[model samples]
Target: MTILFHDTISDSHFPSTSHPEHPSRVQTAWKHLDGLGLTNACKKGIASPASLEQIARVHTDGTIKRAQETCARGGGYLDADTPVEPRSLSAALWGAGTGIAAVDQVLTGNDRNAFCLIRPPGHHATRSQSMGFCLFNNIAVAAQHAIDHHELRRVLIVDWDVHHGNGTQDIFYGDDRVLFFSMHRHPFYPGSGLSSETGTGDGLGYTVNLPIDVQRTGDEILSQFKQRLDRSAQAFEPELVLISAGFDAHHRDPIGGLRIDEEHFRHFLDFVLDVGDEYAGGKVVSMLEGGYNVGVLAECVADHVQGLLQRSLKTGSLKD
Candidate 1:
């Protein structure tokens, strides 16, 4: 497995201490990877920013211009939750580009799977607006890149963030080629993921939402994820697997109320890898989303990365 990352991601910051989405989130996870020796254990590469055309696949020209112009003007708030820094536009482009590089690595057989540690975490940014501390939908841009560039027919995106990926769902709502599955806390922020809110038109059954209660445990979440994924894999047979991996659902996270622990995150990765092995030839690319508790975030990220490494080794995908 190869890990895709960018040092510049740490430069994306808002001038507020109260913000839950901090630069320290990615910094801590990187330090944890070094402490665990995972950094030396896998192949690593620096990520480049996505081009305008690449970003335009999932974001409108106005949205892209707005983010850039905001950054150029010394930064401001896009909304009450989303903030911009002079470096934010650059950071967001790299965030989206890192996901694309991960996809290329796996599809080209340079690596079997990859994990992108990026920030100003996406998944909440819609086609026309940035919200919820997100500036661009990184995973969505990568998914579209696979369809347009790689000519992939089926793609599976599984978002395990505590909050539903309203932006991702919105972007692919009418596209049948992508299957988006999200398991999140219902009646939560940006509340939109309802079981009844499946896809429309050609994408009617492609979008699946499993909105869980706030009090649900990792065990329960894993069981539900596995059950649904198993059924969906049989029909969709995804050519590529993507995970909107978020650790904010951890019991200690201040922003979310789920009871997920490090062990459950490992189990979640295991199930995702199993799906990849069975259907997608063990190809998976995951990107960081929301995991705010700085102390526990690193631990959860390590566990998730370790799971990916172990599965890649077992499947003989790890490079020598």
Candidate 2:
């Protein structure tokens, strides 16, 4: 369990007034992982600045430059929700860098998998805009990294965030090489993952969005997601898998209505690991995107990592 992150990703870099997407989110996760004795297992990775082309791999150049300049200009808002302070771009870029590091680590077998714990979630950032407290699409960039660098023909992104990963879907909307699946609260922020949006052109039927209704329990969510996961992986046979693991759907989260406990969240991770074992050669990378409640976020992330390691140990690759 090599957790990828850097102090550069701290709130000091991306100063904010009182935003929930602050760096404390990662801090909370670290506290819990440490309490669980998992911190020692983490192999810290440095998050270097990503090149314009690296970002352009998944985002439009105009959007990239604009975000860069917007952060450069000191302060502004991508929307009423996403705010940028002076250090916002560098901090946000660090988020993307965290994902990039995790992707490279997993692909090169530095670890069975890696969890990138960084702030300012990225699932809501689209190809051309940032929204829902997200700037750059961290998971999307990592998925593209797998496709381009690994020459992977098929890649699957499983977003379990309470909100739909609209940006991820939009990035691969019509691409056959990538399959995007999201289980989220419908009619929520950025609201575009209706079941009918299931891909287009060369990617028709490749995108699957399970817009679960509000008030759904984690157990119920996982059951439905399992069907989609089982079917989609068999159909796509992806060479790599990425997760947009957001804890905002947790029962205690102030935002969404999904009521999921730590056990259920761990179950979801186990389900993901099952799929990775079957089709991806145990290649899976996860990047944090959401989770505001410090207590719940910490516990949920710890449980998720514990589950991943448990499965790996069970399979004889990862030592407990």
lDDT of 2: 0.80
lDDT of 1 at 103: 88
What is candidate 2's TM-score against the reference?
0.94
Off by over 4 Å in 1: 318-320
Backbone clash total for model 1 is 0
Displacement of the residue 93 alpha carbon in candidate 2, Å = 1.5
Report the C-alpha lDDT of model 2 over 23-83, residue by residue, as the tens digit. 7778778887878877666666666766668788888888877777777888888878888
- How displaced is residue 159 in candidate 2, in Å? 0.2
Clash-forming residue pairs, model 2? none
* Each model's lDDT: 0.87, 0.80
- lDDT digits (tens) for residues 1-320 of candidate 1: 65546565556665466788978888888888998899888778666889989999999998889888988999988878988879888888888999888888889874788888888888998999889998899999999999999999999999999999999999999989999999899999888999998899999999999999876767888899899888887889999999999998888999985988888888888888889989998899999999989989999888888888887877785344
What is the TM-score of candidate 1? 0.97
